[model samples]
Target chain A: MGATFMLGELVGGLRRNLSMAVSVVLVTMISMYLLGLGLLAQRQVDTMKDYWYDRVQVSIFLCVEGSQYAACAGKATTTVQREQLRAQLEQMKPPIKDIFYESQADAFKRFREQFKNSPLADQATERAFADSYRVSLTEAGKYEVVVSTFQGAPGVGRVQDQKQLLDRFFAFMSVVSWGAIALSALMVLCAILLMATTIRQTAFSRRRETGIMRLVGASNGTIQLPFVMETLVSSLLGASLAMGLLWATVRYGVGGYLSKALVDTAFIGVGDVLAVAPWVVGGVTGVAVVTSWFTLRRYLRV
Target chain B: MILFDSVTKTYPKATRPALAEVSLEVERGEFVFIVGTSGSGKSTMLRLAIREERATSGSVLVAGRELRALPDRKVPLLRREIGTVFQDFRLLPGKTVFQNVAFALQVIGKSRSIIRQTVPETLRVVGLDGKEKRYPHELSGGEQQRVAIARAIVNKPAILLADEPTGNLDPATSREIVRLLDRINRSGTTVVMATHDHEIVNEFRKRVIELDEGKLVRDQVGGDYGTTTSAIPVIRLDEAGEPGQAGDPGETGEVR
Candidate 1:
């Protein structure tokens, strides 16, 4: 019966202050939506890191005809020299997982296929490139070992770790993730203060009823339960709305328009969004409940 | 029953006490009138009885509980046992007449079955049975005071304190309110009414305690309103009959 009375008062109080109540809902929804967006961006960055980092390879390009390295001698090292280098590379402790030797002809074929529609494809030839060993590390961070080993070795002109390039790519994304999280936090603070003030005003308007309740032997919890429930109800409405908006944005707005327009890399997938749904819901509900409890504690005493 | 022992209540930053060393007692089921002019500590006395204001010195006992020693948590329980009717008829404007009366029982955690059964019966006692659904603003002054009365007694508290319950009503309506209060008193609820209305005091001829400048000037049993010189002329002429009339002067005027 006590719970029902409190629930009734909560509903009645919300109805009595419709404009303020709507403001609370809107504030909470918009704040949580921004927060959800930030989380989605962070998730996208993590996924991109995983996808690109796994495929990255450190490539050691062999010397060409005019190269000045001592190991190169007068011309590109012979097939026996390349074969010896490959065996030496594999013999290192905690050995590289696998190495693929691409001949100049194979590299040229890949180049041609990649630039099939470009004018450069017509002028490109196998001799224009070099035979290289594309070394796949067991882990991306092991590129340092491969680079140090092959830097001054025979017939090695240049060592390029694709993981470094991927790191630079994701570095930019980390900045964006941080900025979005910061902005969302600021907006959430504003929304929480707004919610607290709105509830305080609601309590002020009904102070007479509260005073009477206090005099009539109602417990402090009994007096405060209605306002707390009011805040929670408004926050829950806001959180659910925010989740719906986030889902729609990720499905249509981000997935369709943004992803297609800027297809520099793979974006967040629908599976990732589904994975983080509980976190988003839990974060929103927790914020709403906690803010309401603290605000009511300060204002509803007496 | 109520007792005050050398009770003194001084507000912050005020030199003098609102109630200064006042001591009084009323037995159970007795109807006592506390009469004083404005600012003579009448309201403070009632507030002390309800434990709304703690005495700065000494103690107050209400219904056998030490009010001054009661903690904030227990104050509400003390109030539940002592019903208070204010001059403003402090009914919640949002609630219906029935809801206002039912609120007292609701606060005490009475079952819904008991609320439904007792509210109408109590309203009938105050002659507001059929007007249950009307809001306070919809009722006349007299009707509102009656609703306040019904709310006060719904819990069947040990004591009923009315701080000018008829302050807003006309003379005839005021008389009716006093009659209702008297009826409640006869039914065994101790009643302490504070009023400045001299006519009602003399007419009812209940025990009256008078105050002046925060001091108890007179306390008399079966006290008339004319105990003090300034109060004599304020009594109704028809009720007081001939001038300088003494009590129980046999055949002072014709029966007709």
Candidate 2:
């Protein structure tokens, strides 16, 4: 009798507030979806950083004749300075995993090949280019030691770490991820408030039943179980909708479209969606139960 | 079986007490009437009996259990043995009469078979057997009160506390309700009623306990409406609506 009566109360409550329950589902779905995306974006940025940072090469541009850099001093690098720089780099082995030298003609050839479609390739000369050494570090993150050692040395114009450029891109990605997470938090607050209002209204409308229940010796738990179950049913629906939408987004949106468009970058797949699905649903259920419990405690008071 | 040992109750932000140093007792199987005008603390006395309100100084005992020592968690257990009815009927509007009465047992965790058997029998006892499927709004005022009464007595509570059960009914309907109460009382359930109807008080001539300004002024055996109290004018029963005209079909079944 208790179970059937409780079921009756739950079903009747949801039917009475069908539109409000739908609103709760929609709001919870959107918030959980955004939260899932934020988590996946963070993972995507981490994967990309690991992939590109492994191959980042430090470029040490050697001075050419007529070069305007103060270190270059309008003098072309002699064989001695060139050989000395190479020896210095070779001695720094272990940290310096590999090194390659490009001559003036090689630099000019590569420049022309890279800009073949540009008009500047037609007017460029070998003297306008500079020879350089492309150094690959075993630990790409430790490029600072190599850069400090090479800068201001004779015949070297500049030492540029490729990691700096990648830093800016990853920073922007982090901002996007964190910003989505923050917005998801705001929407979650809205969902909680909406659910509280829904429970409060339902409790108020059924106060007569509750009062009679109290007079008839119904315990507080018995009076509140139906209300809490009402919120839980709707929130579970919303959570399931959220998980389904997230799976579809990762399966089709990221795996199908994004992976094909950006062929080289690794994006989050459906597996990551599965990983975050439990957290999203668990979090939403927890909030719904707590909010309903509190609202009923204040309003029903059985 | 109810006892009030100098019980005093002062509500928050009130100038005077609702019940002040008043004491009374009703033995088992007795019909007791708590009478006075409005603000006589009769409702407060009932609330204290049900442990809905705590006494400010003294203690209240119902069914031989001191209510002050009862924890809030155990209040429901105390209430299950004491059925209560009010003027408003307090029926769940959406539920049918059977559901309304069955709800009392359902809340206390009665089984389905028990509910199925007990509900119809209790409805028959309240003279509402055929109207089991009717909702509250579909019934007349007297029938609605009957539903409330059925719900209250369905659990076979030892004590029945009625706070103005017939206040909203006409003279004829009120007499029928009082007759029902008297019949239930004859079946060995103690009835404690609070009312302003002088005719019922005088006609039934039960033990009347009158309260004046939160103080017990009169306690009489087989008493009528006395002269000191300012009572509502008695409405005489017409010939067509005499007391015996309302047939008693419920006497065959014992409520307990």
Candidate 3:
């Protein structure tokens, strides 16, 4: 019964300080939403790294006409040169895992697909690109060995390892993730200030009520509980709404938009949504509760 | 119900103690008036009795417990047994009279069913039977004091401490409020009123504890409202002394 009375007080208090309460809710929601986005972005980078890092290959481009390398000999590479290169890769201690030969037609087709919307797409043709041998090593570290052995031996125009490119890509994305986190940290500080001000106002406006409660022999905890619960309930409302909206955004916005837009990329799924919900709701609610309780402890004496 | 054994309370920066070696004992179910001018330690005495401020360099015993040794957390429990009504009739503005009266029970963790049953009855006893829904501003000074009184007694505390309860009321309203307190005292609840009103003290014959500069100058049963440094031609001072000194005299205005 006493619990019910205190609940009534919480509800009444929320209604009485509706504007301040709404400010707390909105601030908490926005900040926590950003926090959730940061976490999700970090998770996305990790998954993308795991997926892409293993499949990355080093492409050994064969010499074409007018290639610069002395091994090219100012003419296209012959089939015998290609055969010798294949034989050398197969003889390694841990054999190279897979190899795919991309004809000039294949390279030009891939280039067009990759730069589908670029202005250069209409300007490229088959002869402008070189035919390449895509070689996957058992370990990506073996690229150094391949580059050393085959650099100027024969018909090798360039030895480019995809791992170098992939590392730079992931590094840029990690920076983006950290930037999101830093932005969210700033927003969280804003959220804390908003909640503290709201609680101070509530305590000040209800100064008479709390004073009377104190005179009537109420415990300090009893007097403080309603105000704490008021902030708690409202922030929880906002955080859960943020979580719900975050889930929808992840499910429909990121998944739907990025999946069809980039087919080779592995997008986060509904399971990731569930994995990240608790941190958003729990973290935001915890901050709001603590801020409110601390404000009341300082500003409102029962 | 209350005993102050040489209690002295000095504020943090003050030169002299607000109360200095003041000793007084009020038994259960007695009406004792603590009469003094402003800053004469009347309110300080009440605050100490309620354990609002700790007594410095002395012991205060209330409801059979030493207040100076009492833990801060249990001070609320001690306060729960003592009802305090102040001069301003400190009713919460947004709450109704019933809520104000029921607030005491709620503080003590009483159930809603019990508060509903007790508040209306207590308000009716204070002659506010049908005005339970009115806010404090809607009530007169006498009515507000009645509500404050109702709030004070709703818990059926062993003692009711009133600090200038009638200070804001007119003379006639003061008498009515005093009569209500008399009725409460007649029902065996100890009422300690701290006031400067000489009329109520002269009109109603009870034990009056008059303090001058934090010192107990007079403790008299059937005592008059002594003027500053002079005794008045009112009720004679009965040498009731303490409870043990008076030999457990049952009530006031009896042997006199």
Question: Against the true structure, whose DockQ is highest?
Answer: 2
In model 1, what lDDT does residue B55 have? Answer: 89
Order the numbered candidates by DockQ, best leading: 2, 3, 1
Question: Which lDDT tens digits does candidate 1 get at residues B181-218?
Answer: 99999999999999866668878999998877677888
As a whole number from 0 to 100, the lDDT of residue B138 in candidate 3 is 98
Model 3 C-alpha lDDT versus the unseen true structure: 0.82
The residue ranges of model 1 lying beyond 4 angstroms of the native Cα positions read: A2-4, A65-81, A92-95, A102-131, A254-298, B224-256
Q: In terms of TM-score, how similar is model 3 to the real structure?
A: 0.89
lDDT scores of the candidates, listed in order: 0.80, 0.86, 0.82
User: What lDDT is reached at residue A72 by model 1?
Assistant: 62
Going through the candidates in order, what is the number of backbone clashes in each? 0, 0, 0
Candidate 2 CAPRI-style tier: medium
- Write down the TM-score of model 2's second chain: 0.89
Candidate 2, residue A9: how far the Cα is off, in Å: 1.5
lDDT of 3 by residue, B15-40 (tens): 88889998889999999988866677
> TM-score (chain A) of candidate 3?
0.91
Candidates 1 and 3, the one with greater TM-score: 3
Clashing pairs in 3: none
Candidates sorted on TM-score, descending: 3, 2, 1
Q: Interface RMSD of candidate 1?
A: 2.2
lDDT of 2 by residue, A242-273 (tens): 88988898889888898997777878778888
List the candidates' TM-scores in order.
0.83, 0.87, 0.89
Docking class of 1: acceptable
Candidate 3 DockQ category? acceptable
